[model samples]
Target chain A: MIYRIRTIAALTIREAARRRLLAALVGITVAMVGLSAWGFDRLAHGGALTSGESTLALPQSLILFMFMFSFVVALSASAIASPSVASEIESGVLMTVVTRPIRRGEVIIGKWLGLAALLAGYAAAVSVLEMGVVDWVSGYLPPNPVLTTVYLFAEGLLLLTLALLLSTRMSTLAAGVVGIALFGAAWLAGVVGFLGTTFGIGALRTIGRISRVVLPTDGLWHGAIYYLEPPSLLRAHSLGQNENPFFTRSPPSWVYLAWVGVWFVAVLGAAILSFDRREI
Target chain B: MWQASSAESDGLVAAGGVPQATAPGEGAATTGSPRPSVSPAIHTLGLHKRYRRTVAVKSLSVSVGRGEIFGFLGPNGAGKTTVIKMLLGLVKPTAGEAMVLGAPVGDRRTRRRIGYLPEMFRFQPWLTAAEVLRLHCRLLELPRPSWEQSISESLETVGLAERAGDRVAGFSKGMQQRLGLGVALLGGPALVFLDEPTSALDPVGRHHVRQITRDLRERGVTVFLNTHLLAEAEQLCDRVAVLDKGAVVASGSLSELLGRHSRVRLKLSAAPAGWTTGLSAFGAWRTEGEWTTVEGVDPDAIADLVNLIVAGGGRVEAVIPEHQNLEERFLELLQEK
Candidate 1:
């Protein structure tokens, strides 16, 4: 089993590393980070709001940068993770490996490990670069930059896993689009839920709670971003607000985290079952 | 045990539908041999595979023997590739089961003893030919010491030794196919499945692959080849199964199937105005221009016809028995179905 996993991981990493999509992803990430740095520089120097003002100052800038970063990260990671296995199956490369003395679950797990590793590495590198720029220009840093980086990386990994699961049953194009759509919708629903909680709107809160449960990409991002940014920033813009009765904290409670883990396993299990039945 | 051997021999002859002349000391050949006496290397019982609503393989059952090169012949979309995939466990059958070496297919242990080369094989573009082979060796759990030598030997076998270091992306389509073949053979599997292995090759390359396949057979490998190239099948296959519309239309030793539909043709210097009447005893005879054609005729009857024609003052040109070529036989089977 270990040997099969290693082989599957090696194959996935080698194939993905050679794809033109990876290069494009890296380039886009760098450009996004660079653009964020430039925009933050102008905002810091303009002095429209004092650095001490949490709503319109450093906190807002940090939240805005993280939100933008998450989109790019999700986009790139989803793009890579989505096609990594499906394209292989379509091209007959998977046939070569799958027909060997390896189990189907081992193949899927190997690909998941490899893509997760890639997402983690990419998220770390880009987050570090963005932190460096923020420190260089704003002369302020988040209290727990490492924690924030870890959270962002974990969110990226989770999104990638979702994309991989979708990929097993759908075309690469459709999987990517659906993955991105789910990510966007979940985040939007979370935001709506937060507003409903703050404004005491019951129906909106229920809708947000259900969407977050269905697709936890947004919930994960919220937990990660809240953990990464300054407490003052999170408090000022109502950013840390969790509207759902199920998750009243900015980051999920232990129970919610456990539920998320269960969700991952269940979705992945379904994906593997679907793939095993596929005709190839 | 010796009695078991005799029973197995009888079973083989019966299952194969052709009797073999027992050679001296052949009974001793069964002892201490890696080959099994009972179960065939591969067996499918009414296997059916469907894609969505379309049936790709329907109730196809066949068995391949150890150390035999079994060619699966069919036109495009005739389930030849589907059956091979099912045997290799790359595709699941909608109904029935495929057994490899007496174990159910899709079983990991069964797959360990099998190798496969898919049609239009695609490899990781960044990998060199040697890297790809080494990776396969690693996956197959070949010993560390054997990796380098096996990689080199596999490349050498495929005539790609000189280009071992070259990235597969830089190689031509035919080169990639050859590399795929090398990967399949690297593990030294006892049973190999090759789908259209020579479909993309030139005539010379095709000949090279055919020779390699024959070499594998000589080394006691069971080869299941799926190809539309009947001529190559005729040359390389000991036995063949012709599939049409998701069913096996005909199967058995090449000679047995071809011999069943024998044709005899005669060329005459003078058109024997009534050759049909003269050759009526030779079975159904037809005159197409200057040639007289007879079907279902024995060799002795053909010789008799020649003698009678010469004795009847009709000059005999040439008496040639027109054997059914693989292509002709394939078409006839397809049309018959």
Candidate 2:
């Protein structure tokens, strides 16, 4: 059984590595990384800012680029993970393998491990590259670079797991679209709730809290941002009215971290259950 | 030898086909009995399945003896694939019990001893043919030491040895189908369920599949074949079960099924005035332009009829015996139903 699961994992990874879409993704990633590097170089050498503002602007600008990169991660993970299970089920590619002596749980776990490994590699590469570019241009690095990279990978994984669960019952296209849409909505609600909290608007704050409970994707992204920005920048954003969507007032609480873990497991468990009952 | 290894794992097969642990030697002991009657390789009791309101299969009971090539014949929407799926544990039965090699349906250990090729399926196109076989070898838990040789032999058997290194993405539909067959034969399974194994193949590929299936049977492997091509079934099946709307309408050995509708066409140089009338006593007779057609004639009575013709002073020139082929019998069965 262990051998079977391992073989499946290896095949899954091998197949994923060969996808044309993955090549396209890497191409776009390279272009984005190069473009960001150029943009930061210009900001440093173009002489557009005072030294005092540059201190705050450097981290601010880096966080903004990080937001785009994180969204890209979420999108890429959904694109791959959504079709990994749902399309196979629809196309009947899963029939032969599942009929073997291996358990269904093994298949699910093997697939998850394969895709997670791929996404983890992607997240780490982009985060590290962007950090290097930032340091070269502005001599500024986030206080906790490793923590920020970990958080970004966690955010991508959370969305990927949700997409996988949806794929068990929905079409691949539907799962991908819905997964990304929920991720976007949660982030929007989090921003609106931050404004509500800053201005003491009770109803708006409630909406943000509710969205976080419904989907923790935005919460995870917020944690990544909290680690990526300097403490001085965070304090500045807090003292002023919360105008920046990328700014984090406080680190994610332990209870929130616990909830994220619970949510991830619950979604993965539900996916396995749905896949078990599903008829090909 | 393969049976012994499989049966050595546990107790006697559970009586009702529900999966349970078996004593290691009970399988061998039960099979070794001299009673002449033994457990079927594939057996189902009132198996049924429904997709919402669509009744895919209903009350399907069948038994395929060991080492026999059992063809499952059915038209479109006749539930042939559904039955195969249920037996292979790919689809759950709605309300009946099924057992394969005396193990309950979907039994993990039993699956190790079984091979299946679905009616419609696709392999991961990125993997080479050799890699696909390797993956299945691991899944089937074939001995690690023999993996390399087993993969090579399976590929060679399917006429795919030279293309083993080629990625499946470059394969034609027929080649892919052949690869699917190779995958099914990977572990030297005790029983193989082939659903439309020849659907995408050209004549040559189909012939190879038939030969492979026959070879498996010769080696004491039970083959449960599902196909719509009547001639294929007629040529290969030892016994057959015809399914219609999820039910077995007719089933028996090929000879038995065809025997009931046998006919003979006789051509004579000349006939006596009352010869047609006299021929009626031997069997049902009708006169076509240059022949006397005998319907439902017994094989032994053919000689007697020819001798009678000579006694009646008529010269018998030709006697052509025709047994109903599967197509005709299948049509008649459908019409009767």
B1-337 per-residue lDDT for model 2 (tens digits)? 1233233222123223332323334433444442212556866666889889998887776667788898889898899998888887778888877667876777787788788888788888888999989888889888899999999999999999999999988999889888888899888888999998999999988898999998998999989999999989988898888888877788778887888677889899888776654687667778887798887777778888888888888888999998878898899889888
lDDT of 1 at B157: 94
User: What TM-score number comes out for model 2?
Assistant: 0.90
Model 1 pairs in collision: none
What is the C-alpha lDDT profile of model 1 across B101-217, one tens digit per residue? 655677676676788999966988789999888888877888999999999999999999999999998989899999999998977888899999997788889999999999999
How much DockQ does model 2 earn?
0.76
Reference-based lDDT, each prediction: 0.77, 0.82
Clashing residue pairs in candidate 2, if any?
Answer: B10-B22, B10-B23, B10-B24, B11-B22, B11-B23
Residues A162-263, model 1: lDDT tens digits: 888888888899889999988888888887887887788999888788987888777777676665556565455476544342222366678877888898
Winner by DockQ: 2
Alpha-carbon shift of residue B319 in model 1 (angstroms): 3.5
**Candidate 1 backbone overlaps, count:** 0
- Tens-place lDDT digits, model 2, residues A1-280: 6776787788778887777665777788888988988888878767998777788888888989999999999988898889988899877779989999988878887888888988998899888889987898768899988999999999999999999898888999999999999888988999889888888999999989898888887888888888887877867766565633687777789999999999988999998898888777
